[model samples]
Target: MGHRLADTSSPARLAAPDEGIGRDELALATRNHGLPLEALRYDVTPPGLHYVLTHYDIPYVPDDTAWRLSVTGRVQRPLHLDLADLKGFPQVTTRVTLECAGNGRALLTPRPVSQPWLVEAVGTAEWTGVPLRLLLAAAGVDADAVDVVFTGADHGVERGVEQDYQRSLPIDVATGTEPEVLVAHAMNGAPLPPQHGRPLRLIVPGWYGMAHVKWLREVAVTDAPFTGFQQSVAYRLRQESGEEGEPVTRIVPRALLVPPGFPDFMSRARVVRPGTVPLEGRAWSGRAPVTRVDVSTDAGRTWREAELEPDDGRPWAWRRWHFGWTAAEGEYELSARATDAEGHTQPLQQPWNRGGFANNLVQRVPVLCLAKEG
Candidate 1:
């Protein structure tokens, strides 16, 4: 493959300011003192801090001069590519939602040992990049290849092991043609932010964020399955101690209700004027398309099918759903649940796991309806 240098004529955007808070403090106070959460209020795609999640305290910023992505092992042609070289290949863009594996860990009873992210840890973005399979095909994978290992630039000691962030997928999944995977270089029409993995990152549509390795530097094609620390040790769902847990893969089905904030509640505590209030939110699944969304205005006692948006056919993107409610003065406990095409549905309560991964429990919102002034 041909190699080229990236155009450096344009000035880079300023990086987001780091709050200088310790990891523990940031995790505990995320809703307020940590990264701001106001962006999550948006209906289409959340903006600012809501768009990305960073695992470590500091994000790695690579110098363009020394940065390169290498593909080796079990390939007919080993290749080294720079940013411009990757951009030279045909570019593809798609909108995908990414959620951290430990998204709802804060809600867990005993709490898991990780970033205590609530629902705000998820976001959707339009990503632009080169198809990863193109690069893999250029390398000509060996017939015996079983797994494709991805190694990121980020490195540190985790769970007593000092290693770079890495993970792998089956060769078929990595090289699949449908719902194409990307070596993404841009997010929301801009060069990726440092917090979201600048220069290059892997985007494994339909999988948890852990499978999308950031600051990607190496792709190793192997004849056997990879047993990397991030893949085999962390990000796995374990029911108890000492048992090898199932690898956290596809996202479970979930539906979120966007509450009517501030002004609506400011008039009265959790109160909305009696009228037709439009209830809306997003629903998604990694295993299959979201087939339906059910909304409940009186806890789980009564339910109504919400109008769902037409799927754009992007497997990784979420579908927006809406329900119009005409209410009289009363108190209501609103909630939403989603069902997927594969028959998987959001549960009232997700099974307790040691890592608190895949917590797709139904979300509820409390509201009081006040009669309109005569």
Candidate 2:
């Protein structure tokens, strides 16, 4: 089955600039929280402060002891392993930065009508689990296996299609060792939080958050490309309704600023005292290491290179960058732009798509430089 479309109108739609956020989007925002810009100061976001977006309800798993992760289909040796059994495998820990494909959806001119995110749907965390390749090796992927489908316990309906929240990886990506994917059971050194996928989750470093199937229970190796809802109908980069656009895979390069100074309660604009002000933030690229970060205090009119910190050896994690600004007493605008080793850079103007995926527009912040008390 390929490209399942909703016969009668669908839930997914786009909102024009003047229409504003609808009630449905607001409700989704209430449940799916964004990372507070201030929390960008931390290298690893705490569970609560980290962004959360659940497509369906968080399934309650009172007893994970009885739960078994089944690895089946197109494999010689199918296996069912319990939580303890998974823990028994030789463990590897990885630091990963997961960003929602729709991180900047709300900022789009005719915004995608789903999550309504405004660039805060991201967080970096230390993930611990058994490497997915190890399990595949043990199971013996069939000669004709093409895609490995991951099925999570969370189930829901989207665009008139009901699915169990499934996604797949090509055989090469599923087995690659370069950035080893994990059947993660721990986040930030602690057992997975309930919202983060209590018993288990699939962590595909560098890929969008949708690829990280949470509350994972089944890993099925398939002989054909998996055309389930997520893999085909959703998450594609289509401009028109039925176009099968490019697949949204590795994350595009993105840089976020730690909003300077304090925020007003409602407006949330920044206020900085006049003088030399320290500026810093994080940058990451799933495509390659973030090689450069540029700061622009006057929108994108001019840019200054910020010093990048040496990579901490975590290939998939975000890197910190710093810049200093001589603050004169005046109103100003601020922004950060990132470039990856692959030469991909943030676009000053966001590229539009139906789903609003991979919108790496430079982050612009408004700042009021207060005069010093004489």
Instruction: Name the top lDDT candidate.
Output: 2
Residue-by-residue lDDT tens digits, candidate 1, 187-262: 8888877767887899988888898888889999999989987788777778775679999998998888776533
Task: Identify the runs in model 1 with alpha carbons over 4 angstroms from their true place.
Answer: 1-25, 28-51, 261-270, 370-374
Give the candidate number with the greatest TM-score.
2
TM-score of 1: 0.86
| Cα lDDT of model 2 by residue, 322-357, tens digit | 899999999989999999999999998889999999
State every prediction's TM-score relative to the real structure.
0.86, 0.97
State the displacement of the C-alpha of residue 143, model 2, in Å, after optimal TM-score superposition: 0.8
